[model samples]
Target: MGEHRDDLPLVLLIHGFPEYWWAWRNQIQTIADAGYEVAAIDQRGIAGSDKTPNSSDALTLAQDISAIARSLGASRIVVVGHGRGGQLAWAAPALAPGMVEGVLTFSAPHARAIQRPGTHLTLRTWRHVLTTFVPPLARRGLTDPVSLEHLLAEWSAPGNDGASSQAQIYAAAMRLPEAAGISLDQLRWSYTAVQRPTGRRYFELTKNAIEVPVWSVRGQLDPLLPERAWRQDHTFTTGNFRQITVANSGHFIPEEVPEESSQIILEFLHHVAHQA
Candidate 1:
């Protein structure tokens, strides 16, 4: 967490699955030192946030971000997210136009890009996605520190010595009452949303090009998302957009390469500030 100043731009950091506000521990101070206010939040139903059953749909989650921004007294904010959180960041401008000044996403592509014809999910990614639908299996996996550690090691770039410790922390968080269930619910909704009317409306609303500036970053070694998932994302943005690949990194770019991530974020913040 950083000081909130009305004059300074608010950078809202939203974490992906199996992570809470602590996910941004590496970037928070760096951003604050650069003269920006930062707020890394634990999305609803995870960590300290309330567990509102069945409210993990895209529309609801986006609304939560908007509400948090407003509550923080921010007229506009730069949203930074990873994985599923990145998907929500992509949706923010469309769901709450004028509320988001810019977006910086890590390891996640635009929703349309993911749904585009011929796009495919890697087997590793599919395994995690499928686990969400199986409650017992999902819970078991999340609650076991060893399983989480294995996942982190698999998903992260080689030689990430901190992955095991991070997994232990995440495993402990997941053991909180109902936290595992909520996390699974969020993933489950992502997979089955297409069959629901609300999900259809959500996609429709975001069908148009994003008018705000966007920066998409991914680790070069990330196996979860292929290049095809985000290579053509420029077509979905009518405003300024850029794609960056961090060499030797993996799915968890923020933690895998904090210095580089911080540098990229600072550059984006400078761009957004000058653009405004």
Candidate 2:
């Protein structure tokens, strides 16, 4: 809870879907060692954090991050979001502009609403819809450590190309019995809330470009967020931004290449500090 360095700023990390604060364990240590306070939180319904019934929408999730930042006595924070967390990170700064100093995301697109029709419609989103519609089954599968482990493993190794050892480690984390603590309704809420209001309310206020510095990191081999999304989002930012692609890494950039990710983050912070 203590800020790492008196002179350095704080880093607020938001973990991706199905992952807890542990996702940033290595990054936190590395960043903290460099004299920055790191506050990595378990997003809603993922861990011990608030499991609000029916609360998986991106807007609500963004609010959760804001609340966490305020609770830590930070008026503004450098937000680092991974995967789904990145999406929320994109939206949060818009809703609470004064509370965010900068935005750094890995594998997350901008806050634009996902078009329901056409090729852009992905199987992954359908899976989320199914889970949202049927809480009991989705909750059952998500809470089952074994099932969750398998899901994370599959996510890590798309088409059997990823490292088996890494996949096993991710799977093991999901399989922990503690995964069953969150209720089915809570898990379902986490997904459904985002699709509500046609996914427009949150982005409407964010339509104007964000003025904060932004960094979007991508893995060269990541299957979750293809290069196409990155290209489309490249032109959407409002302020100064940078996009870096991590070689040979996948969606799990922090887990796959902690040093490279840390280096990129460190350099960005240093640049931001000098500009300030």
Q: Largest lDDT belongs to which candidate?
A: 1
Reference-based TM-score of each model? 0.95, 0.80
Candidate 2 has its poorest 10 consecutive residues by lDDT at 157-166
Q: List the residue pairs that clash in candidate 1.
A: none
Best by TM-score: 1
Give the per-residue lDDT digits (tens) of candidate 2, residues 1-276. Answer: 334666555678888766778778768877887778789987776656655653555667788778887888777578889887887788777778777778889877774633323444346645755765665566555555566656655555254322333434444444454443443343444445355683567656667777778889988766555666665565666778888888878777787777787888888788766655
Q: RMSD in Å for candidate 2, one decimal?
A: 4.0
lDDT of 1 by residue, 135-241 (tens): 99889888899998878878888877445568888988999888888888888877777787878888998888988899999888887887777877898899999
Q: Candidate 2: which stretches are off by over 4 Å?
A: 1-3, 113-137, 157-195
| Clash number for each model | 0, 6
> How well does model 1 score by local distance difference test?
0.86
